[model samples]
Target: MFPGSETRAGRLLVRARRQGVLLSRAFGGPEPGEALFARAPKPWMRLLPHFLALAASASLLPTTVVVLLGDYGLPGVLAGLLGVGQAAPLLLAGARPLSAWYVVFSTDVLTALALLLWGGPLDGAAWPWPAPTIVGYLLLCLPLSLHLARRTLVAVWLSTAAAAVLVGLLRPGHSPGSSVLLVVLSGVVLLLGGALRERSEAQRRLAEQETISEAERSHRRLLEERARIARELHDVVAHHMSVISVQADSAPYRVQGVPEAARAEFTSIADTARQSLAEMRRLLGVLRSEGTEAEGGGAGPELAPQPGLGELGTLVESAVRAGVAARLTVTGEPAGLPRAVTLNAYRIVQEALANVVRHAPGAEAAVTVALSADGSALRVEVVNGPPATPARPLEWHGTGHGLIGMRERTRLLGGTLDTGPTAEGGFRVAAVLPRNEPAPGENA
Candidate 1:
C-alpha cells in the first residue's frame, strides 16, 4: 500500500482528505485565479478552465526538452518545437471537453512516441513521465463525462495498461509489469472520484424531492382545516338561526285571545324578528358554503313553489305587512321568465325590502320590477324614504355583516345593487338581473 492511499481487495483507496496545499502550488489557488480575471464576464469564465489545463500541459514541456536536448543531442530549439506541438492540441482538448477524449489520447501517445524516437529505451534522456499532463486531463475531463459505467471504466484501465507497457518496453531496463500496475492504480483513482461525484449528485436530487413533497403535504393540510371550519360554522350557526325564525313566526298564533292590543304588538315584533332571522340564516349559509350549493341545485329548503314574476304583487304586499310603506310598479309585460332568473329577482327584491325595515324604519319605500324593450333583462329597484326619526339604534347591532352579505348574494347571481341617499331626501336600492335562466344545468 502507498502512504497517501490504502490497498484493499486488490484496489487502491485514496482517502477523501483535503489536498489543498498540493493543488495550490500546482495550479495556483482559486482566489488568485478569480482576482486575476475579476473584471471579465461570461466568455472569460467559460474559457478559464481550458486556460488552466493548457498551463498544466505546458508545464511538462521544460522537463521533456531538458532530457532531449542534453542527452539525445537534439537541438534545444527543435525540442522546444516538439514540446509545443504536443501541448497545443491538449489546450484545444480542454476547451471542448467532451469532444476532446480522442484528441487527448492521441496527444499522450504521440508524446510517448517522441520520447522513444529521440532516444532509445536504454537512453537516460527518455524519462518516461507524462504525469503532469495526465493530471490536467483528469481535472478537465472528470466534470465533463466521468461516470460509474462498468464497461467504460474497464476499457480505460486496459488502454492505459497497454500504453504504459509499450512505453516501458521502449525504454530498456524499465519493467513493463511495474508500468502496468501503475497505470491500473491511476485508473482506480479516476473510478473512485467518479463514484463520489455520482453519489453527491444523487443526494442533492433526493433532498430537493423531499422538500417539494413536504410543501405539498402542508398545503393539503391547510385546505382540509379550512373546509372543516366551514362545515362546523354552517351546521351550528345556520341551523340555530333557521329554528329561531320558525319559532318567531309561530309566536303570534300561540299567544292569541289574550288582550288584543298587546297581542297585536307582540305579533308585529314576532314577524320582524322572523324576517331578520331568515335573512341572517341565508347569509350564514352563503358564507359557510361559499354559494357552492347554488351551483349544485339551490340548497337548503326545497323549492315547492318558488316566487316568480307573476308573484311580484304578493312580494310587495308582504313588504307592506312587514311595516314598510311599499308600492310595486310594473312597466312592460312580465311573461314567461326562467326559474333561476325569477328566483334571483325575488331574492333581490326581498333583500332590498328587508334593508328598508332594518335601516330606514317607518319610511315609505317603492318596489319597481321591470323588463327591457327586447325582454332580455329584468330591472328591480326598492327605494325608500329616509327614516322618519333618528336612525334606529338597533340597526348597528350584531357583526354588521348583513349589507356585505346582500352585496355578495347579488354579485353571485350576476346582478348589481346601488344603495345611497336619493336627491329627493330618500334612500334608494336598485338591482338589475337577467330575465332568462342560465342553461338547464348552469349555476348562478
Candidate 2:
C-alpha cells in the first residue's frame, strides 16, 4: 500500500512545522560578548508563521488521508484522530503557541502508546520516533522558542529532553541516541529565540532614549528665549527709568520754582529709581549667566546724556536730513514732567519717524509733543504720508521689533498708544502718558 511513503511524508511535514524555515528566520546566534543580539527583525516576519501554518496544514492533512486510504489495520477512528491531532498543533501555533506545543507533544506520545498496545499497528518503524513524533516535536520547539521567556525555554527544553529519555527507556525498541538528538534540537531552537528577544529589547531602549533627548533640547531652547526677552526688557524699560531718575534728581537747581520739599520729593523718586535699576541689573546678570551679555551684548546702547523730550529738536533735524519734510512743534506750558513720560514721548517719536523712513520712503512727516493745559498728561504724535515713490520702499527690513518695543514700553508705564494707517493715506502713532504720576509709596 506504499505506507512508508505516507509515513515519511508525515514525518517531514511535522519537522517543517517545528524548527523549520519560519523558526530559522535568522540561523546564527549572536557571537559571544557581542553588544546584545543585533537589531529588530524585518516587518514581514509575522507573516512567516502564517505561511508555515498553511504549508503544514497542506502536508499533514494529505498524509493523514493517504494513511486512511491504506487501511493500516488500526481503528478507522484512531487513524482519523491521529491525523487531526498532528495538524491541530501546527494550526493552533498562530494564536495559542504554548498550548499547541503541549498538544503536539501529548498527541505524539499517546499515538505511539496506542500503536504499541494495538500490537504493531500500521507496521510503522519505531514506537515514538515515527513520522508523527518528529513532526510534533518540531512544531512544539519552533513556536515555543518564539513566545516563551529565556528561563521558560530552558525549562521546556529540559522537560522535552527528559520526556524523550523516559519514552526511550520505557519503550522496548526506542534508542537513547534519538532521545539525545531531540534534546540537542531543543537547545538550538531556544538559542535562536533568545537572540531575537535581546534584539527587540534593545530597540525599545533606543526609542526611549531618543524621546528623552528631544525633550531636553526643547527645554534648552525655551530657556534661551527667556534670557533674550530679559535682555530686551532691560534695554527698553530700564534705560528710560534711569533717565527719569537722573532728571528728577537734578531738576531742583535746574528749575526756578521748585520748593525744598519738592526737591526732597524728587530726590526720593531718584533714589527709588536707582535702587530699582540696581535690582534690574542684578536680575539681568542672572538671566545672562548662560554666557557674556548673552545676546544683547554689553551695557546697552550708549547715547549723549540719555536724550528725552529735550532732544526732540535733534531727532526732528535728523529725520529732515533723511528726506522727510519734517516738523517738530511743542504746545501748551512745557514744564518739567516725570522722567518716564519724557523718555517715552521721545522714543515714540523716534520709532514712528524710523518707520516712516522704512515703509514710506520719500514721505512727509510731522512730530508734535503737546502738554495738557493742566499739566496732568503729555501727548506725542508722529504722522507720515504713504511712500511717494511706491515702487521702491526701503527694503532694509528692521528686526520687526520696533513696534513691539513701543507697545511694551507704553503698557508698562500705564499709558495708551494708538497706531495704524490714517484716512489721509498716511500712518500715525499717538501715545499719551500721565505727566504727574504719584510719588513712590503714594496712592495712584
Candidate 3:
C-alpha cells in the first residue's frame, strides 16, 4: 500500500457505512445497524466498560504505532492500526459485549500469529499479546459479567485460557508462568461477571414478591374496615327499626272504633317492619361477627353474598304485601353493576318503598332501574302515584332520619339523590350511582 493509504482506506470504509445509513433511511426501512444500538446495556452499568477500553486503547495504540513505525515503517503502521482496533470491542461492550470478546480473542491469536510470520519470531516479553491483548480481554470481560448468562460466560472464560496457553506453548518467547497468570486473570474477570448477574436476578425476584405481599395486605385492611363500620352503626339503627315495628303493631289495637280495613293496614305495617328488621339484623350480625368468625372458623353462621339490585323482586313483593302496590321495571341491559353500586341500589329502593307505605298508604309505586347506555352509571327512580281516595292517615309522625339515611347512603356511594313530592302529590326518590366508585368515609 502507499503512504497514508491505511488511513485513507479506513476513511473510505466509514464513509461507505454512513452512505448506506442515509440510503436506508431515505428508502424507509429498518436499519440492521440499529440492532446493535437498540440492545445497548443500561446506563449505570455501561459506562465503566467503555471507559476502561478507551484508556487501554489510548495507552497501547501509540506504543505499538511508534515501535512499528521504526521497524516495519508503513507496514508497522498497519500493525498499529490493529492495536487501535481494540477500541471497537470496548465501545461495543455497551451493546454486543460478548461479540466483542469473541472478536478480541480471535484478533489476539491472529496478532500473535502475525508476530511470528511478519514481525519476526517470538523473542521478547511482547510475544503473545503485547499491550493490546491484555487490555482487550480484560475490559471486554467486565460487561460480559454484567450481561451474559452464566453458562456462556463460563465457556468464554475457558476458551480465553486455552487460547492463551496454546499461543504460549506453540510459539517460543513466552514462559509458562506468564501463560498461567493470563489464565488466572481471565477467570477472575468471568467470576466477577457471574456475581453481578446473580445479584441482579435476586433483586428482581425480591421486588415481585414485595408487590404481591402489599396487595394482600391491602385486601385484608379493607375487610377489617368494613367490619368496623358494621359494628358501630348496627345497634343504633336496629333500635329505631324495633320501635317502628312496635308502634305499627300496637297502634290499631290501642285506638277505639277502627274499621276492619284500618286494622288490616296496621297488620301489614307490623309484618313489613318485622321482615326488614330481620334482614338488617342478619346483615349487621355478619359484619359484627366478622373478626371472631374469621378467627374461630365457625364461631358464627355464614351470611350469603351481600345484597344487590338482584333482590329488588323480593323488595317489590314485600312492598305490595304492605298495602302499597309496587312493581319493578329495568331499562337497558343492566349487564351488571359494581358490588357497591348494587348494594346501595337495593338499600335506596328499600328506603324509597318504605316511604311510599308510610307517607301515602295504598298508593301505586313504580320502581324503575335504568343503567346508563355506557354502563358507567345507573339511575334508580321510585315514583309513587297519589294514594287512592284522599283520607286522613294515622297522624303519621316518625323519625326524620329516613331521608337522612338515604342521603348518607347516596353520598357514600358517590351517587346522586333527588327526593321530593311530585307535581301530582306523590313522592319520588331518584338516585344515580357511578360504577366502582370508592365508598365515601370507608371501604366499599
Best by TM-score: 3
Per-prediction TM-score to the true structure, in the order listed: 0.40, 0.50, 0.51
The models' CA-based lDDT, in order, is 0.51, 0.61, 0.61
lDDT of 1 at 264: 70
Sorted by TM-score, highest first, which candidate order results? 3, 2, 1
lDDT score, candidate 2, position 366: 45
lDDT of 3 by residue, 103-205 (tens): 7778777776676567743444555666546755776777677666778888988897788777777755456655566678778987976785566456544
Backbone clashes counted, model 1: 3
lDDT of 1 by residue, 367-443 (tens): 34343312766676666655565445335332222334345545645667666667756656566665553333322
lDDT of 2 at 237: 61
Clashing pairs in model 2? 14-135, 18-138, 18-139
lDDT rank order: 2, 3, 1
Give candidate 1 misplaced runs (Cα > 4 Å).
Answer: 1-51, 61-63, 66-68, 71-82, 89-95, 124-151, 166-174, 240-444
